[model samples]
Target: MHRMPTLSLPMYDINHQATLGLTSALTTLLQQRGVPAEVSWPQDLLPHWRDDQLLLSQTCGYPLVELLPDVQLVGTFLSSAQGCDGQRYRSWLVVRSADENLTLSDFRGRRAVCNSNDSHSGFNSLRYVIAPLAQDGKFFSATRFSGSHRQSLAALRAGEADIAAIDCITWALLRRNFPQELAGLEIIGETPLCAALPLITSAKTGAATLEKLRSALSELTSEKRYQDLLAESLISGFNVSDRAFYDEVREWKDRAAALGVTAL
Candidate 1:
């Protein structure tokens, strides 16, 4: 017997309760269409997508571009937030609002934090913006990984770090749901916009199965209950994404490398 197809949304699972609810609703909808689906939150989602049993998941543009030939783009999410226009999103270079004397240049030789080295909105976007300003491929006096945008914000707030690059969609959601956490933070700079995270299925997933997945996403907005879930998740809808859309991210990486600021 074939194992049930699995789906995961590890990238946007910051709000555990809400993510579970949203994915559960999607799973229910898929099952109703005779597509047996189950939700799984693996410890590390990057490797999980390579599983032949994988049916669906969302991944960052950097990984999506780097991990090509392993995963196939299925769709992209359009968030109902500022800094997001359709499937394009940007990153905000943020510092504590109280740091009145600081500017983007002032961040040089200071501590900086990012969600991960492989995150487009968290690291690559910020690197692309800072590359020209960077000297000898170096900008910050010290840099560290907080593992997620939310943590990066906290590190800045607690004085553990001087600044962070936050995904604008994550920042907007935190502003709406947890305003207290962001009360003293402000965006000091923004990176050029790039395609947002794209949904993916195993390269082995067949055309018919991919069509079923796309159909389910299109039907999400038509129902009131699912609409509510989408709002809670801060997602407006999904769109068919072109493979060329992520080329900008690859270009940014190459540009940064040329400037000698290849890693954060």
Candidate 2:
């Protein structure tokens, strides 16, 4: 007898509280339908990728596209509260107390820190905002790539850097989790709205299977028990979204190429 396929889903630590609940809910939902898919957090999912398993990775716009270039996205998901009003994702460029008096233009000649080049909120989204202001050889006098948003924020907080771009979603989460760390800084400006993170599957997955996955996601949070699980994880909801939403990121890539920040 042929075995039903298993699905693995990995998400970052910012949503660690929600990952297990999400994984279990997905696993149960798929199993009830005889699909036999398993969902899990990133660390759990990463080690099991070699066995022809289906993966459901949750990531922000930049890393999702960069980290799993081989995978085909099934759909994009965003919390109700995290959705923005336009193409530009709503994010902020936060700076330490010492730089509170500086303007956006003043970012030049200062050291700027970011989480990773693969981070949309950390890098790509902000790149679109900063590229326009760059001309000649002038932009940020120096740039540093921290590994995570928390690290980037800490760098600024400790005076190791002058400014960093932080997504509003993570910003709100951090505020709720660590108020004291944020008290020493202020948001200087908002970047363009960006596409939220998405749910992706490997290219080997079938179109019919992808449709079923989308349906499963649409219904995942509707049950009361699942809703409670989401609440504990700080997830509001995952709305149906598509790739066109990410075209703005491609636009940023163009801008990145134009401005010589081409490594993205």
Candidate 3:
């Protein structure tokens, strides 16, 4: 008997309950279709994407574009959240609510936080928005890398940073699950909409397996049990996607580099 393939949905694994619920739902759906999928969480996700057993996973647009040569594009998630429109989503530039008097220009020479240098919505998108405003390829007085969107928000809330860009889907999920975390933050600006996160598979994965995975994802909305899980996960549905869809992220990177603004 052949070994079953593996799945991982780490992008939105914010908490124990949410992650487990989503994993269980996905596992059951794939298994029902005779795919024999198992949910496996890795401490570091980048390495796992290259694993031979990787059947399906999700990754941000920035990394997706960077890894296009190594990974196969499967689909993109659609969210009912405000900044999301089908496969496209944007980021909210947030600051403390008390900083209502602050404007984008005022952010100059102030501390800024970013989730990661490699993130589209969290870092690259923000750099693109600030590129025009940047002077000498510099904007913030000091920039900090928080490593994750949640940590970036935490930095702002704790007064360690003046502003940060957060993915709209993550912002929506926090609003639903932990409203208090956002009580003190306000969205002062938004970036242009780009392709949202994409579902990925190893480049070596056969087309037949990819089709089975896509079919399983499409069935989520119609299945009652999975519908509830989708609601909890803030995932409305998935749309068929291809590598070309992520070219915009590459453009963002190129534009940022052209402007000499590469991080924060």
Candidate 4:
């Protein structure tokens, strides 16, 4: 069994306190199930998801297969968030209410913003949707990186950008906790649902401990005792994640690249 020094998982950081509260409860459940994992926070702005000592963490679909193939996929969180269906989720292309009459085609040559280039929800998904609409291998006149979903929303609020693709879970959490952030914003378009962020542990985790994690998470999601906690965190349940689930996500990335839609 790998020695799990800490469990660092902030699946949705917009309402980080809620995630913290839920994680604390989950850690207690893991311990009760003999995993003995303790919840901890990432030490840096960009989390080191590949850390050998990691017990469990959630990562975007893009990086899960592209960068961290060796990590053990525990399961996908079934979010109660609007764009979520079971364990799959999608990105919502959002614009201000002032632009409600405009459609995806109306945004051509418009300014675009995203959390980061590596982000599936913010970058990859948006690119995939816009690929077919791109002319001469371009769509948005300019692209901006806001560093996070909330920051991307901030850019739209301040008129720094016209459109941004935000993860639905982040949208739901912020809407529940801080409605002001999205006061004037409205979802205009969406990418197709694909594999969402799934909980992961280090590849070094042994089979026994892996089984313990699955059992604990299953109990946490299914039992009535933790219903309120799960609802507060916006997580509906959990589902088994086979790597095959991410095939289309990679295909989306490839399809965008083939259409030369990287800049969006």
Better of 2 and 4 by lDDT: 4
lDDT of 2 by residue, 128-225 (tens): 77776777635787778987888888889888889888877678667766677687999888886767666777667777777777777768856666
Q: lDDT score, residue 127, model 3?
A: 90
Q: Tens digits of per-residue lDDT for model 1 on 1-264?
A: 978778998887666788898788789778877788778988887778788888998889998888665787889989987888888999988999887457788888888999998899889998888898899999888888998998998899999998888988888878878888897888888887899999999888888888988888888755776877888878898898877899999999999999998886
On a 0 to 1 TM-score scale, where does candidate 1 land against the true structure?
0.95
Q: What is the lDDT of residue 85 in candidate 4?
A: 89
For model 3 the TM-score comes to: 0.94
How do the predictions measure up, each by TM-score?
0.95, 0.83, 0.94, 0.94
Clashes per model (N, Cα, C within 3 A):
0, 8, 0, 0
Q: What value does the lDDT take at residue 240 in candidate 2?
A: 62
Candidate 3 local distance difference test against the native: 0.85
Give the per-residue lDDT digits (tens) of candidate 3, residues 1-264: 766677988888765687788777777877887778778888787888777778888888888777546888889878888888888999998999988667888899999999888789888898998888888899889989998989999999999999999999889888888888887899998999999988898887888888988888888765676776787777888889888888999999889889888766
Compared with the true structure, the alpha-carbon lDDT of candidate 1 equals: 0.86
**Winner of 2 and 3 under lDDT:** 3
Tell me the deviation in Å of residue 250 in model 4.
Answer: 0.5
> How well is each residue in 167-214 modelled by candidate 4, as lDDT tens digits?
988898889999999999999888899888978888888888888888
